[model samples]
Target chain A: MAKGSVVAIDIDVSRRLGDRVIAAHFTTGPGLTALFGPSGAGKTSILNMVAGLLRPDRGHIRIGERTLFDGATNLPPEARRVGYVFQDGRLFPHRRVRANLLYGHDLAPPANRWMSLDEAARFLGIDHLLGRWPQSLSGGEAQRVAIGRALLAGPEILLMDEPLSSLDAARRGDIMAVIERIRDELKLPILYVSHDRAEVDRLATQIAEIGE
Target chain B: MLSPEEWGIVALSLKVGGVAVLATLPVAFGLAWILARYRFPGRVVLDALVHLPLVLPPVVTGWLLLIAFGPLGPAGRWLESWFGMTLMFRWTGAALAAAIMALPLMVRAMRLSIEGIDRRLEGAARTLGAGRWHAFRTISLPLALPGVLAALVLGFARSIGEFGATITFVSNIPGETRTLPLAIYSALQVPGGEAMVTRLALLSVALSLGALVLSEWLVRRTHGERQRRGD
Candidate 1:
């Protein structure tokens, strides 16, 4: 595949769970590319490979001009400059919400930093909740904090791994609205993983259906 | 009340134990991090080596320390030649013996705490552009602190009560290597030394018991905090 888009994931990654084979080979462009698949279909695995959390068994993942992973050059996760919002809202428990949100900011190079902590907090509507620890936040509030955290790093790309999977239906829309605002306001590429068809139908600009 | 000489014994014990633990804490934390987070070749062997003191006879452990730390020994020779520091038959030697005997307990407590931290938090930090050291400093180290504190207390308790290793490695020398346990034993060797032994034993019991209770309370507080956070 040509290294043309702002983000590219034309790679083959396979995971064997006892007897089942969950494999993916897909590419995405500038906008939101949703990996829609059933449970255990390895949607998150693909995202992990892109984020440099898991090295792909074959093929390559290129974001902008930098190749994150391939045969020899498997860039470490910290160097990937890709913000990830995990489904479970993996906030640092000991840290206050403000600290969690600002964690990525210190490491992002001045050139890559497109936003500040205050801006992220304002955009995510998390200004009032900054002083509290993560354990106290509601699901929707936690997800918002997680998003703000990823965004503060000023990543060129964002990866949402079933970000709303753990939330109740009532809170899902609140987070969805925040995600939409993020997409509309930011110029970064996004790879959203989800099992919900309706969510993909609503937010995804491109769809790659994984699993045989 | 402890007699003047008895008071000296108690003071020496506290000083030796405190210095040993304080001296070894940073090294213990480094080892704990390695043991808890990494899987390298001979990992099992390294684990066994670290816990050897816990399973081995303290006298045997002291013998090992002596072999490595005596003035004629290679390590001891180098240390003595370079820094004028001799760790045999000195009060410093007793502290060294105490630290070695107590190391496993300290490392174990800290390692358990380090392992308990949600590794994904470090992963998250990494994705945010934080390097390994930065992630460890800001996330893993802070999260593992209570356990580290508990480890220090446990090490101190073990240090103060260290007997076999202290006796064998440094020997019981007053104003030098004779700590509380050695003093107790020396008192027992004489006829009218019962009262001295009794007072020293009671102090030892109190110190050990206090350390254990403090460690237990810290562990429980950490657990309670986790539960409160719904983690």
Candidate 2:
């Protein structure tokens, strides 16, 4: 493993969903690491563990020099500073787009807030949607807002859990462009989960196959 | 179209109902959240205890309250000695009875809404750097608002209609504990007070109907919001 790696995850965790036991174990380093696997292959579970949303029954997670989880320490999700864009954009229904974008931004400490709400909205091309409600936005538009919301939180690493899976082909291309810009311009490390071979090949600097 | 005395009864009813709902709101939400989110030992018993007042006879509930909160009882004695307060035969005691009776309905409504909320949204909030309490307050609480409002209205309606328990526990003091139902019952005891009884009963009916309608509207609104969100 490179000492300068953006994220280091060597985790073994199993979750019982009904009678099926979904378990995962993998490790990746630096830049954009793609977890490629079919559906129900526990790809999202890995992203969840990285984000501290799911605990590993064993092993450890390290992002940069900080130890997120291990036998001796387990940091909660809020303290982990991981930006997650879910398959379904989980925007708060009660808040307007602007409020949703700023929800995490406001909670992040002043020094950690690298992006302003305006900058994020403009970057995601959601500036006109500030006054709109989450329920009214299109699927693609909602995902952009979700991305912007996550970025404004100033996370140490981004976790995209099949974010493009729910969009149309055109919208997928558009979001893929956005992700490419994020990879190149912002240099933010992303742990992307996708089964799309083309998407993984196009966006990933390192690929880790799961359940192969 | 009521006299000053009748108006006083309406005011007292509103006060008691409002206070009962307000006081019970936090306790109901807490219990509802617990019931909705966690599976733990004695959960069934806790749930049953919450619903006990709903099933128990109003008079029995009143008797229990009197025993527990009366001047001679342990809680009653503690309140009297420590806080220089008394509940026996007072409006506060009437409000307490109303709160207890209204609790189960409030908790049931709140729990349903809380349970209906997607836990994933809370997880999203957590990944956004919100602590558990912060995420719950901003996400789960707002999502559950309509249900909570409906619960409050339902509880208020139940409190205003509280009759047997209020009468048995507080004995329907003229101005203090004589809410709408109690006043109507009191009017029935007097000869030629049938006219007053009829007027008060009609008012009670209207109040309850309005609350029911409002609660129904709130519940529908919640469903509509959820549907629009594609949930």
Candidate 1 local lDDT, B1-231, one digit each (tens) = 667988888899999999999999999998998999899999999899989999999999999888988888899999999999998899999999999999999999999999999998888888999888998899988899888989989999999999999889999899899998899899899999998889989999998999999989988887678657643
Per model, kept true contacts as a fraction are 0.76, 0.75
Off by over 4 Å in 1: A1-24, B1-3, B78-84, B226-231
List DockQ, one per candidate, in order. Answer: 0.54, 0.54
Q: What TM-score do all the candidates reach, one by one? A: 0.90, 0.92
TM-score for candidate 2: 0.92
Superposed by TM-score, candidate 1 places the C-alpha of residue A133 at a distance from the truth, in angstroms, of 0.9
Task: For candidate 2, write residues A1-212 as lDDT tens digits.
Answer: 11133456454556665665556666665578898766887888888887888777777777777888888999999999889999999998888888899999999998788888877877779988888888888999999999999999888788998899999999999999999877777778888998888999899998876763
> lDDT score of model 1?
0.86
10 residues in a row with least lDDT, candidate 1 chain B: B222-231
